[model samples]
Target: MENPPPKLQVKVTADASGSEKTVHSSGLSVRSLLKFSVSATLGGKDLTPEELGELLSNGDGLIRFKGEWVRVDARKVRDLMDRWTQAARMMSSLGIPLVQGLRMLVNGPSGQLVQIPEPDEDCVMEPGQNLRQTLDILAGKVPVSIPELPSRLDALMRPYQKEGFSFLYRITEQGFGACLADDMGLGKTLQAIAWLDTLRRKGRLEGLPALIVAPASLLSNWKEEAQRFAPELILRIMHPSSPDPWQPEKNLRRKDCHAVITTYGMAARTSALADLHFPAIILDEAQAIKNAGSARSRAIRSLHGERRIALSGTPVENNLNELWSLMEFLNPGLLGSRKSFESFTRSLERGYAPLRRLVRPFILRRMKTDPALVPDLPDKTEIPAYCSLTPEQAALYQTQIDMLHAVLDEPDPAARLMLILPILARLKQICNHPAQFQGTDDYAPERSGKFRRLQELCVSIAARQEKTILFTQFRSIIPHLHDLLSGVFGRSGLTLHGGTPIPERQNIVTAFQKESGPPFCILSLKAAGTGLTLTQASHVIHVDRWWNPAVENQATDRAYRIGQHRNVLVHRLICRGTIEDRIDAMLKDKRRMADDLFSGGPEQWLMNMSAEELNNLFFGSPC
Candidate 1:
């Protein structure tokens, strides 16, 4: 048998003016009408049939070939026709055949399929030739295959499987602004790191120039956690000794680091460093930029970046305006002017739009209770300890309260304000002992029912299989509590306070959390309340009360935050009949006031309550 005839290949060219040439297989037949019309479309009305034949014969030179003003590559057209015919044959073999002549199919791979137009149907199939190529060109194309992401991303994101993670992923992917509003110790850092790691895996991260603007105190902690969680990532701490701020690009390039952790102070003063463009910039403890017009805020705003993320547990710390500042940084013009933002916030409190749209896409917040992955936390048990003051301490407390009430009644507002610090100091001293602040060296027995009750609770916590943190407003009381617990339980207790030095604080807390030996830690309310993670202790004792609920909550968070497997028990010890009860009542009202004011809601009665009303709580006696 004879071999099948070789398929034909042709090259078509359009000249600078307008032209074409056609080459065909020697055995193929050409119709006279097809040849005449093809030449007419190419040369316009000027060329005759004989001239067109001559032009086709001289295929080596550039000729004017036309099908509108579009330039079609002949090689591309021929290749497309071959692919179309192959695809059609494959489809037919699969029991699906394309109908010819402008037919459409809804279930086709490209969603809809249309047949190629014929030459005589007023559609010009120029020098390139063929209905298959025309059809292939008309079909919309599919994108190239997307490579699979790294398998490690699943392991990395395993820690953040909460609904909040979806919100975070969307924010980073869509460049939407977001605030992670989770309470302290709810794993905000983990969520952020996971997001960054995803970006790295997806090849979206570039230059490896990410800046984590955090508090000076948290700089090292961030570095350690980043290293622990993302071992593959390289980190450089940007400090005064690191390198010249003017040359961040050069220094970062030299080290080939993926991230840099720095404090707000360093980021603000280092103007030269702000010039380098980073692909990803994250601000940890973003509340540091609460003042929109501050130097730190301006410096961060000046820093160039393709993506920006802000992380803060307290995004609306003292004002709603602070939230606007953060939104403005993430997406300018989204929130409009400060004045407009304030107006929008008013309506937003009433559930209005545009304002909600401006904020909803940018902020992803979750509470500790929101994470379904984590088991239910231990219920916070507030064991109110009723303690009676020693006779001397009781006398001193009465004397102080009386004087404070007198001062509060003074005509001058400044005089009344001046009395606050001293009154608070005296009250705190009385809770522990008169000697704690006054240095009187007078010994006082713990006679208050609240004090006796706390001692019993401490004994119970010490006997249990768990650990406990006892918080007191008076640092002087830490040693006393430690001594009391030591006398009762013996070497099973430790004390932590402000003077313990920054480096040793973490060490002490770690030891307490590990529960290798010690069963209790006595902590000053101010010092151990924030920043430190003490997830080992299941029980927290508030030996004294604070005026700010957030402050007390921060203290509770030390033990209750991430990693605790048991339910956290919180004890708020308040004296039954003293200034402590009065103050606690006042604080509840103050917290409501602060929340309403900061949330851009209408002011509460607490904000307008007179100093006389406050004085009445302390001195006028409950009816």
Candidate 2:
């Protein structure tokens, strides 16, 4: 048998529909020919380049060359091309990164049967390389042995946490950054400590030490956990107040420490701390860096590190751009330029799966609601208690606005600010309760909206026999809440505030945890939001909206943390049609600009609003 007229010519045409290219010669496209050529080469022994030319030169019959005859299997080529196309399409659409992309192409439906049995004949590809090994591990073809915790680890990990540790190790092994975004109270701290410990034991962190930057309040928490769990590792706490002050840039080389813990405030403010290099840098409550332009985010991003990981329960608490911030910090250039990242994200409201897939290899998140993680965990529900302001409260709100207007006329800007700050405080107070703003013990439910909502909420909590934690920013309003909730609960509850004595705080926490204890507990948000574990209360009522979701979530976690046997219901009491509502909408929108707007925190939020803006925010809609 000689050969068909023309051997095999593949013509490429522009595809308007974006489907695979169409073929012209024998109705076979270049893509098809490429796939076929790969199969012909891989099906048997390799063919030398000169031999390949002779086979293609035949221009027909059964691809006979050398002394061998290889049949071009049409059906096999189609089937194989379809698989390759399927995986390739997914990779292309998601724009999966290099290492992950190759792994997917080789394992995902395409090369499942064979680890790319042989390189494609058309392209220059290295066969039998490290990439194949990585693919093997990713696809589970090569078993990933979950290593035991270091002998020095005094702490134990949950089954899921151990899995998390393995995930981080595998990704970093490929020279990539990762974000550990497990839900709040899910032991992200422990998983991070485990990663550091593993690296320490493996002697992989020789030239540089690991850095942990977190909120000032949480610096102690990290120190405590590292001491309790990674007892084998040395620790350094960077502090300005210490007699032997620590400065990372100058002192880092001389320090003999496995990990350095510092606050985002300290890190951002101190040049030395921000300039020090770390083998690994982990940011706890990573939302602090959600604003790419903020001093802390800028400072943390400036610090050099071999591996970067972010720990946050609410990674995108407000919006998608915040996710970009975290991603930018983790894998800077991986997501492409910020402008393009933002442009593409705008179209991803309903369909974010593609973006998720792209970053899948770099992010590991497990919510407590996962049945495998917490089989017996109770349901946690979030409810918004929208309320209307009482007519009397509305009247008082107007009076405060008037005072704010009067203060705007102060000749000195500083004096105007002094008056404006107190006016905003008064406005929030009037919203909480008219009596609070008046500096009197007026306890009239008819004068407040939040009070009425709390009253309504109590009836339901009473019927369910569940405990509640009522958090307010104003301590002055707590007595009113305690008084009001006591009647509904039919028993007095506990109250903790900033001024509560240190010794008495534990007693208050212990009492509230008991099943037979009070049905509700009240606290000022700043005081009890961080340290306590009040899991006994299944219901957490936000008497007012805290500016940051992270702060509010921290408060809610008092009950949502581990050890709660019953479902938790979080009720956010918000007054409708006011500044609160406007701010609520801003948080909901979560656009990139909104992140910058909110990044300054509450003081900036209050002070930065122009008089006109503040006026519109308050008077734009009826209370």
**Can you give the lDDT of residue 430 in candidate 1?**
74
RMSD (Cα, Å) for all candidates, in order, is: 19.7, 12.5
lDDT string, candidate 2, 1-623, tens digits:
97533222211111111232331111211121111123224333455545545555554447654455555434444444455445445434332334323323322212222323322332223223333454345433666555677655434667787788877776555456678888777778888889888888877566567888875545555666788888777667786533454566566554367887777778788776555567888898887888876777877778877777888877775556677788778866545556766766675667766576556767788887688896767888887788888888888877877766677656555565677767767767877887887788978786788888889889988998988898898887888888898888888999999787544666787788888988889999887776467888889998877777767877888788767888889888777876677777777676553555664455655566676766676567632
- Per-residue error (Å), model 2, residue 457: 6.6
lDDT for each of the candidates?
Answer: 0.58, 0.67
Q: Please, what are the lDDT tens digits per residue for candidate 1 over residues 205-323?
A: 54546777876556556666767776666667777534433246466554456777787888888876667877678888687787898887978877865567888767775566887
How well does each candidate superpose onto the true structure, as a TM-score?
0.65, 0.62
- Candidate 2, residue 89: how far the Cα is off, in Å: 27
Error of 1 at 260 (Å): 1.7
> How far in Å is the alpha carbon of 531 misplaced in model 1?
4.2
